[model samples]
Structures are given as structure tokens and as C-alpha cells.
Target: MNGNRSVPSRAERLRASATLHVFYGGIDLMVGSRFVPHLRSLERSQWYSREALLDLQNRKLRALIRHAVDRVPYYERAFHGIGLSAEDIHSVPDLANVPILTRESVQNHFHDLTSDDWRRRHPVVNATSGSTGVPLKYLFDRDCVAMGWACLFRSWEWDGYRMGDRRALIRGTDFASKGTPLHERIRRHVERNLVLSSHAMGPTQALQYARAISEFRPTYVRGHPSALAAVGKAMLSNALALGGVRAVYTTGEQLTARQRMLIEQAFRCPVRDQYGLNDGGALILQCPASDAGLYHIIPERAIVEILRPDGTPASPGEAGEIVSTDLHNYAMPFIRYRTGDLAVMEDQQCSCGREFPTIRRIEGRIISAVKRRDGTRVTGLVLSDAFEQLVLTRQDCVHQYCIVQNADLSIRVLVVAGRGYDDTVTNDIKQTIWSHVGKGIDVGVERVPEIPASRNGKRRYVVSHAA
Candidate 1:
């Protein structure tokens, strides 16, 4: 496959995707997305120099601004309001006049959110029921999706995945129903991925999941980071060992340094971190290989900027709202979209020799932060990870969880239990939290029938409206 294959048509891609999802994994080339290998090669080219990377970045940024100026209504208003045209957006600094679009704006005005011609055109609408408070609905052109996944594939390859290596996905197991549909299971059987339910994992169940890993003996493990940590926890207890897997790639949650250390210890392999959202516009990643002090963001895919609370450009190494412009999302270009997440930008080249721009720190979703009894706010990413390993701890249970912190300082979890795990696991979680938060905090339990999905049909580990 070419590095820049034209994105497949939406109708054609959607039908095939639907058909594949009914089964465990898709082996059909018509429905197959060659994102992994594409990403691998792209990442391998990190050797590009600063001059080389910047030249490509400027070209792509200019093209992206042009796409927005001509097509997107939001950008049209923004450009006119700022008294600038696409040609005037010659340097990265010129991007400052364009105001940032927040997540609320996107969800509230979804219909009017896109470029003027977007409806007449078709976009690959992608959704995220993130671990944070709200679900995001956004559109991606074929090129953007390809680039995003390509970056991921590169991360995987760098961590030690060969082109034909056997792979396993520990995320999306519950949503796809674990290969039950006959066609879906058959597809997965051919593709070599076993979908295990994260909802069923617990401390004891972690042992069982470990046994399954020993049996599967996959070459590479890919999916949610928190879930991978659960598998590591399971492997820790049971003395279970994997035969062939050499690397683990964790995404979907913030990979804490603590969890990363444990995952590396458990798997005895290099653990790589990738940070991205469903909609186009990011490539904040980290690896055991380098500490370049910034995200090695793919230059040609998106242009990222950090903006302060007052909407001014954030200086290097200063935290601010993440704003992005995807060069290739022409179908519905997102110009100056505020990602809600916060990070510091760095223009320096990575020590690994990749000229990709790096972001120093990514503070995920501060808006969804939950305050603790100590008055210290619990960041969404931090709290989500603290609970993630537990959720995917065992695979023999049915679990739904919520972080219950009331005005009374009483802390407990609202959970729907599986057949064997009820009070025991709940108590364990309570003890774990109390150890961290301190004594005298009332820990209680609310056994709900099920964890309620937010408006966008995805679960949120922490959902509070307060900022």
C-alpha cells in the first residue's frame, strides 16, 4: 500500500466496517485499514532534520488554512474577523489571530460545526466516549485518520513489532461483545486478536487473564494502557509468563510513570506511550528510548499550538489549552479547535534524531477534574488511571464503576458486580483509595444495576460539571 493512498469512500468504508465489527476481527481487505504499517514507516523517518521537518510543516499548515478559509464556516468567520486570508497565514505566529473553538462549541453546534461544504461532502465521523465527562463527535477525512493511525503504527514498530507479528487488542472488548457474532469471531480468529472484557477484570480475575495471556502468547500487545496494567498486575501475582510477546503499546489513557514502570517490569519489555483523540490533531507520545522534552508531533499531519487562559499564544514549556489545525482533514477541517486538554509545546528536535515537533507535558482534561476531600483536585487522567487497572484486573466478572465523592467526604464506588466478585473487590478498592487519600474519610458502596453511559453512549470514569 502507498503511504498516501486516497482515503476510502465513506459509504464503502462504513458498510465494510459495520460488517467487520459484527465479528471479532476483520481479515477482509475491503474492510481492512492498513494503518499500522503506514504508521510504522512514518515514525521510522524521525531522522529528518529541523529544516526538513519545518519546510514540510509550513506547506501543510498553509494548505490546511486554505482549506478552512474556503470551506469551513467557523474558520470563514474567524479569518474574516481577524482580517486575514490564507495567503496571509504565512508563518506559525500568524495563527494567533484565529480564535480557538472549544469542545462545547463543537457539541452544541455540531450541525454548523463543519466547513460550509461539509454536508454536501461526506466525512468519516468519528466519536470519543472518553474517560472524561463528555463524548465528542468530530469528523475526519481519510487522510487524517490514516496519518493518525500511521503514527500509532510507527510507535508500535519502534517498540518492536514486525510487519507480520501476531497482535492482541485488550481494549474495545466489551463494546464489540468479545467475538460472539460468528462472523466477527471468525475474523478475529484469522487476524490473531482476542478481545477480552475489561469490565470483568479484578485482582483475582487478573490471575485468570494472565493464564489466558500465557496461552495466547501474542507477539505484541496493543490497546488501552490501564487495561495493560491490569494484565501486568495479574501476571505479577500468578507467576504467569508470556512466551513470544516482546513489547506492549498503551493508549486510550494517560500512562503514568508509576504504571509504565510496573508494565515494563511485568511484561519485561519496552512499553511505549501514545496520546491522541478520535478526532484528528495530535501526536503527543513518549518512549523509554528518549526524553526529548516535547511531543514528537507529526509535522505534515497537524499544526499544534498552546494558548493561555486569555487566548494568547503560550510560550515554550508553558501550559495552555491545546489548539490544532489538521492539514489533511479537508472534508471538515478543524481550524484552531481547542482540545480541552492542556500541554506545553516545544519546537526542539528529539534526541532520537526525529525532527518531529515535541510537546513537553500533556495535562489531560483538567476541566473534568474531581476534587478530593483534601481539597486537592483529582485530575481526570490521574483518577482514571488510578481506577483503570482495577477495571481490567480480572476478566471473569461484570463490572461498572463510578467515583463517589460527596459533600460528606464519604468515598465509595458505585459498581455492578459480576457473578463472583461483589463485596470483596469493593472493599479492596476502598482500602486502596483510603490509603492514598488518608483515614477518617467515610468509604461506602453503591451497587448500581449498571454504570450509566453519558449522553454520547460511552462510559465516563469521572463526571463532574465543576471546574
Candidate 2:
């Protein structure tokens, strides 16, 4: 979002939700071609082409309008009240007449978001991981899962990765055990993967992670960016080699330029980023190094759109909301549902002639707002990027810390203390942070073995205590 983009009024936000709920409640979203080769072929067809992307978008859109007009209780009433008919909306070109979806709409009408048949058999339950506030229990079918994996594979391929190539996932999985026992080691050798525990990333634990990666000699390193950043920092101090990792795939949290620089410098590989919220969307992957990535809207599986704050269509240059339609996941075919994120659309033909529509930048969910020392409020918790810039000048000092804003404007800092933990250095960091966020910054420190991570292994730089 632009610095000047005002927050939507309560009523406008509500109305946007109403429109989303009514429209989504009515549509029968469907998808096929779950394999990579099939998907690659489909890219040449009507739905994946630029004309087809727009055409299918409009066609399905008209179908949605018809569904809402005929079946949706709320949408039928709204369409009737507007003096419009399903017949009036001829194509996706006419989608403008219909309202845009919003986060509020999804939350308020959660049950109405899907069809009844979708709730039955083969309903794959998935969640948004709560990175954004409105964490939803979504549904997907087998095809949805396959398409998601296929999209992920495409990201890996962009990074010079091939199928069956050794890929080390530095993430927490149900697979991790207290120790790699005989059976687990056998599995690792067979699968050619070393699963690192996300929760165990302290100094000693990092050594274990490093040893695992070094021994595996994986072709690509993948995990939450924040977790990888911590591992990168650890590798820097310990002089642990990343071995043969030609690429690094990071997802979940926003990848800072500084973090990217550090990870790339440490791993000696292109640190690529993939975007997805598990909100009825597929993984939006890109090789940032190639500059050929536009987060190609997965045509056969998902329909993507950018909506302005007024529930209006956001043109090329504007930063607006991102919404997706999960086509393959009929169990939770989130039709034109709003995802509360700010992203910019780019219509420019990419340097790579893939002809896929792209999103230039997705300014993620802006929810870190908090009261500053001056009584003013800030909405994002990314103030840590301010601290993330701090280099590791000495190996003996605490390198990173997160500020937790409380309801009373006070802040608490969670830190990784160095060997010689003392008040002097701690005071210096506290004072420096206050210098940036402002003076009179009542900050307290809590020294832990290491920073805590979410179940996904992503580190939150700043979190509201209230959250």
C-alpha cells in the first residue's frame, strides 16, 4: 500500500464484505490439469493466454453472476435491489458492475463461503497459517494439492532445481524426531533429505542443522525466510559451509533486501522467494535473480485479481488488495474472495516470454500497527527491518532482538544474548533502538537461548503483545 492510502471506512469495508460473501456463496468454482506437464500445456490454451486469462476470468465471472442471481440468497436480493439480472452481466468485462470482495466479508460469512457439497467427501482441511489475522480453515481436493506442489516445483526449476534433486527443507515437520535414529537416518539416506527442526535453532541446535546440511550436500536449501536468516547468521559466525546449495527457497514472511543479501552472501546462491497464503491460492513462485518472475497467476487452478480500496479494479501502477479464486479446490472454491494484502499489478510483458500476467510487488498484510512513544499509532510490526540492518560487528554480543509493543505503549525485547551478557551492551542496544523508534522508549529485555519461531519456522520481528 502507498504511504498515503487511507484505511477504508468501517461501512465501506462492511459493504465490500457483503458483496464478496454473496457472490462467493453462489459460484461453482472448478479446476483440472493438476500435473506440471498438463498445466504447462494448459498455459497455451484459452485460460492461460493473456486473452484467455482475461477471457476465462470474465467467463467464469459471468457464470458467478448467474449463480448469484439464481441461487445465492443474499446475492439474489442484492442483484434484484440493483435492478440487474444475471443476463445483464454478459461477460467478465462486465465484472465492474459487481462489487469486490473483502476480508470482512469472508470472516462474517465464513460458512456461506462454500457450497454444501464442498463440505462433504474429500474435503482437505487447510489453514492460512495465521500470518494474516483472518486465519481460515480452508478445504482443497487432491488436485489442489498436486497443483500447489507443481507450482512449487516450477519455482525450484527456476532456481536450477530438477525433480529428485537433493532438497534440504530447514523446517519443522511431523517427520522430525528427538534424534535421527537408525530408521530415521535410513529414511534420510533414501529420501536424500535432512529435515531440521524449526523450533531447535539455538546456537547448539544451529550447529546440528549445519552438520546435517553439510552432510546432505543438497542441491537447494528451502525453508521460511526468517528461519533461514537466523541459520544464515549462525553459519556466518561458525564458518559452516552451505556446501552445494545452488538455490535457496524462502516463503512465509516478507523477505527483506538485507536478509536476502545476507542469505545470498552466506549460502553463495540465489535466494529466491515464493508467495502464498494458503488462502485458497497456489504458491506464487519467482526466481528473483532471473527477473523473469511475475507470480504467474495459476490459470487452471486459481484466478487472481487486484482490487483497489474502494472495491474497484486497481490499474497497473496502483497498489491494491489481492484476491484469488481457487478453481481446483471446489471444496473451498473461494470465488473472487479478498485476501487482505496489498500488491501491485504489472501488465508489462516480462523479459521472459512466458506471457503470464504478473504482480510486480505484493506489499503484504499491514497489521503491525502500534502506539509509538509520542502517542501516535503505527500499523506494521516490521520495525525490526530497522534493526535487521544492524550487522554482527562482534561475535561476543547479542546480534538480534524483536520489539513487542504492548497496549500501554511499552515495548519488550526478546534477544539472543552474547557470552558476556551485561547491562552496558544491553543498555547500548536499548538506547540505539530508542534512538530509532524515538526517545522515552520503555524497552525491557528478555534473554533467551534463541528467538522463538512460529510452527512454520518464520520469525516475527515485531508482534503486538495484544496479539
Candidate 3:
């Protein structure tokens, strides 16, 4: 151990543990939730046999279906119109009989989707980031929120994280911003969470965040991959590193290969990618037991189905849309809801011995693709790979970028210049993009101070306005 390094005293550690217990205990008591119990159940449930997991899903599904049909007006009417009932959906496969719930449908039937017994569930209203131009408001029960935290904590355990472990959060939610309530500030301090805003991740902000995180010495760092990658780049540029970070957890955005590499190099820790949707009720975490980028689906949290366009289940290795049923959300059930995200189905069991189903890859949102003039389409993953490679090879040339496709199929590359940015770097970016998307399209590279984030403070790498 370095003599200069500061270690927490025994009394400080005991105080931190007691504070965490009181904080979580107060929350559980206020909401009538059993968070710690739920977390413990999940820890054991993750190792259940495949048949046991499926049986658990079936039981949860039956109960949820009965509740939705009896209490939710939207599901009740839809089931009646389709000549179906809760009895028709006894198993996961029987869910095919239910209509696919779309975002537009939810918006139209907002009030109808709420369960009649929602008042008893301690409901909380929430909204999506409206990244698609229209935000959708929804309801979440207190128990459902508690289950979400339990599922997340269980996933974090794959990286050796414990409940009271010190961690840093670098995402859109700015807990340190002005006007934050005193209680919220105290809660953050008691929880030992270092929250850094990702809204404006310029070089200066990135440097500051890097310095703060390094000094904080968190066991793990969690944030959007883009934001973390920016801080990682800053740390590398200034030769700074967070000495004791065991892992980096990335969510909210796709974690590209180059981004993962940069983060791992800067933090000297492995990067774990997590896929989740608060509105959609899907939580997929990277399989720590495998290096193949496979994600394990939490069976107790949501029942995920990878279905083809025809509404049939996709075969293993086939790419399909993700439809999820959040089992714990009774305030407003999302049964067979279309999440609009794509993923590849995997049929193999993980070496970790967890019976939870797996996904080979998360292909991102369905609408995040670029169309070419010749009717060809390039997915966001491909474009991100191209841009990431360009940045990796020409290090310090580009801090951030957004590839926007105009209605006319013209491509505009908006770049936040880095220290080593030059004309050659711009040409390299253009060439990289042209390689993936044919040169027949008009491509322009523009240097900017920063790329704008969405309403939720997520910086999208690809935005297509072409219809």
C-alpha cells in the first residue's frame, strides 16, 4: 500500500455501513417494500435451473395476466376484442395470443393502461426521455422500483460489487447541480456516490470529472459509455488513473469496442456493459463469465422475447426485435410490449452456471439506422464502429461526434475537435464513413464545440432524419 494513500478508518467504515442500512431501511418502510429480501432472493434465483426459471416466469405471467385483464381497461378491452382471456395465456409461449403493445398505443391509451388497483401499489408517474420527439408518460409501482434496484445490484455483484461499496456515477442526472434539495444532497453524501453530470462533457469538464473520480477512489465507475469514454480519454491525455477501480459499468448507450478499450486502459479495470429500459422493463447485463459479450437476461424482473417481424420467436443466432413483459409492474402492466430495440438470440448456457437466458448482442434502437441514396441502409452499430476506429487510430483527434443524415440522404458529421484535430483527421473521418456508406452520398464534416444531448442528456452517435 502507498504511504500517501488515504484509507477509511474502522469507525468511518462502520458509520458508512450504518448510514446505508438506515437509508435503505427507511425507503423500504415508507414504500412497504422488501428490497434486501428481494435482492437476496434474486441472488439465489440467478442460479436456478432452466426449468425452474421458466416455471417462475410462468407463475408470474399468470398472475400478471389475471391482474391486467381484470384491472387494466386497455388490456381488458384488447383481450375481449381478440376473443382471448387471462386463461388463454398460461405460459410464456401463450403470450403470443396477446396483442403487441406499442409506444403509440400506450400514449393513446395512457389512462386505460393503469390498473384499477394502482392506488394500493404506491404508484409513481414517470416519462421517457422523448428521444423519439414525443415523451411517453407511464406509471411505476413502488415495489417495481424496488425490484429494479434489486436487479441492478444483483448484476453489479457479477463485478464483485457489494451493497455499501463506494461508487461513482457519471450520467445525465446532476445530483450536484444548484437548487438540489438539502436532503437529496445529504443522501448522496451518506451513500458515498460521486455524481458527475454528463450533459456537457467537453475537454475541461472531462478533466475535472477525471480528477474528481481519481480522488474519490471508487471501487467501480458507472455511467453512459460515451461519457465514460470521454473521461477516460481525458485521463489518458493527462496521464491520470483511478488507482483502485475494480470495474467500469456502462449503460444508457451502446458500448463500442474502441470505447471499451479506452476505458479499460485508462481505469486499469474491465468494462461491463449493461442494457436496460426503465420504461420497457428489460434488464440485460454482460456475462462476466464469458468474454464473448453475451448478456444474461434477469428472468425474475422481465420476460424477454426476441420475435421476428411476423410476431414469431426468432431462431437462435437470428436478429429480432425485443418484446418484454415486466412482471413486477402492476401499477401499469407492460405485457408483451414492443421495446423497439433489436438483439440477437442466443441458445447456449453460460459457463457461470446461471440459467438466465442470454443475448448475443444488443443492436440498439430500430430507428437508429442511416439510409443511403441507393436505398441501402447502414446500421448505427456499423457507423459507430467506423467512427470509433477512426478515433482510436488517430488518438486525440476527435473528442465527440454525431452523424446526422438529412432528409435528402446527405450525411453531416458534427465533430467536437480534440487537441490533435486537423484537416487530415477530418478527411480520415469522412473516408471512414464513406467506406461503410458508399461515396455516392454527399458527406460533410463540420467542427463544433460540442454535440447536443437529448432531453435526458444522452448523446446519440447517429441521428437519421431521412424518411
Best by TM-score: 3
**Candidate 1 to truth, TM:** 0.71
Per-model lDDT:
0.64, 0.62, 0.84
In order of lDDT, best first, we have: 3, 1, 2
Which candidate would rank higher by TM-score, 1 or 2? 2
TM-score against native, each model: 0.71, 0.73, 0.91
The list of candidate 3 runs beyond 4 A from truth reads 1-23, 175-178, 373-376, 419-428
Which residue segments of model 2 deviate by more than 4 Å?
1-33, 42-49, 59-110, 119-121, 128-135, 176-192, 288-300, 307-309, 313-319, 344-349, 369-382, 391-397, 408-411, 419-450, 465-467
The predictions' CA RMSDs to the true structure, in order, are 8.5, 11.8, 3.7
Give one digit per residue, the lDDT tens place, for model 2 in 86-179.
Answer: 8887755564665555556656665665545554436677755565545656556655665676566555545544434577887655345455
**Mind giving the per-residue lDDT tens digits that candidate 1 earns over 261-380?**
768888877676667765547667764356543456666567777788788878886767777777667776676777777776775656665666677766666554555666766555
Which of 2 and 3 is the better model by lDDT?
A: 3
Question: Model 2, residue 467: what's the lDDT?
Answer: 36
lDDT of 3 by residue, 395-449 (tens): 5687678888888988999998878889988788889888888898889999998
Clash list (residue pairs), candidate 2: 17-105, 58-92, 368-379, 368-380, 368-381, 369-378, 369-379, 369-380, 370-378
